[model samples]
Target: MLQLLRKIAFPFSLIYLLIITVRNYFYDIGVFKSKTPNTPTICIGNLSVGGTGKTPMIEYVIRLLETRKLAMLSRGYKRKSVGFQLGNEESTVLDLGDEPYQIQQKFPTKSIAVDANRLNGIAQLEQLIKPAVILLDDAFQHRKVNPHLSILLTSYACLYPRDWYLPTGNLRDSKREARRAQLIIVTKCPTNLSEEDKVAITRQIKPKIHQKVLFTSLDYAEKFKDDLGQTVDDILFQDKQIAVVTGIASPEPFIQHLAALNLNFEHLEFSDHHHFTATELKRINGFDVVITTEKDFVRLNGKVDSLYYLEVAHKFSEKDKSVLKETLESVF
Candidate 1:
């Protein structure tokens, strides 16, 4: 029935595409204005709605810029508080959203700022800390502030180059958005991905003559305990049947990472940024342990004990590290 409805609505979807296409045309033809920043800007974003691994990739860049003066910026999606603010000190899931807070917590020294206005946010951040490179999180569609280098992220399962516009499918905008990015990466790849698969996917994008393509996989960090505080493999993940939980854009990678650990568990998937209630907790009465992603843990304001979260850290290889650093340095 759902499939039938979608097929019936296909003509309406085409109308949406036509509307989007006209809007994009104006911007492309320069009838509409585009904004750019004074400082060096590198945006880590996806063309589609979600699940392109932007957070993990942002974290990767943060670690790389440890030695340099860097300030991380974002629109702070779903943040209760408006206007620009420091992403580290004033940040909370309530104020700055989960993604910015997590970034602040992980990279203590790196300057962080969050605001809806990308232009104003960058200006405020530049006034405070003169950074070498500013990473704008989830700014793929934000064409106003033209980034020095735009990184287009595509999930291993969902490639945006072949995807259609939204209300019809998962894309927030047109696939032409890929043309704006200087770099493209196929993220959340399996550890044992073949060279053939990589070549085939890269062919779809056609390389744009000078654009660089890369592949990245998730690297799970050590086991963490309740509320993402204690690091403990002894209690939560060891010697018990577990119920894994997560409210994220993409839960497949999280599930896959857990499966690789060879742990005995039952999976419980939730909507992105789901707020759990006491009744929902009570429903999973039989599970011995409750594990969730750190992103999901941020939304849980309700009281619950014995629930642990495995904090995964994204680690890029030495070669990948050098490639990123060298490429970024050239632009900055």
Candidate 2:
């Protein structure tokens, strides 16, 4: 039924394509100007709407630039606050959005800000803290502030070339815009992806000569941890009935990980950045144990009892790591 509706929406997708193409053309011809920020900025974004593993890739970049004074800027999707807001110790999910709030919590000392206007956000970040480098979260389409380095991400399962515009498929921008990126990372890949598969994906993408392609997979932690830093053994989970709760763009890989561990649990999935109401909270509270993604844990930590979140990080092969180091170094 969903596939049928998507097929029916093909005409709408064409309209979207025309609109985006015109917008890019304007930017290309200098009718729409792109300003470069004073601070060196890196953009990690995807062509698809969701499920592209962007946040994890941003975290990976953060680790790479840990030696420098860093700040992150985001649009704060679904956040209640408006205008430019800088994250502080008192910031919550409502102030900075889930992804930024999660990042703030992980790197407590780093500066995080959110604004609809990328230029304003970058200016405010520079004026206040003067970070050595700024990481722009999900700003590939925001051509207003031209980033020094742009890293494009595509899911191993759903590459941009195979996708169409919104309503019909997940792509929010044209696949041709991918050429603007200096590095293209294939996220959510199989850990054991063979060289043949890598060559095939590169051939399909047909990247420009200046662009480099890298592959990365998710590494889920064996144990689950709660807000208080209490952890439960992975094997002990078999003794109780568990519920897998997630409010993320893609939960399939997380679910598959649990299933591969031979665990039995019912899944309670929600939309990306979904807010839980009283009724939804009641339904979630019925489970003996609730395991959720680290992103969702920020919202449900105090709201739900017996709640635990599984940690996930980007995993790159040694070869890819070296290539990533070289590519990032070249940016500076």
- Deviating ranges (above 4 Å) for candidate 1: 1-8, 234-241, 281-288, 313-320
Cα lDDT computed for each candidate against the true fold:
0.77, 0.90
Per-residue lDDT over 170-242 for candidate 2, one digit per residue giving the tens place of the 0 to 100 score: 9999999999999999989999999999999999999999999999999998788987978887776777888
Candidate 1 clashes: the total is 1
Worst 10 residues of 2 by lDDT: 323-332
Error of 2 at 78 (Å): 1.0
Q: Which stretches of candidate 2 lie over 4 Å from their true place?
A: none
Residue 223 C-alpha lDDT in model 2? 88
Worst-scoring 10-residue span by lDDT in model 1 = 297-306
lDDT per residue as tens, model 1, 165-239: 665567777777677877888888777778798899889877787687788777777666566476787444678
Name the best candidate (by TM-score).
Answer: 2
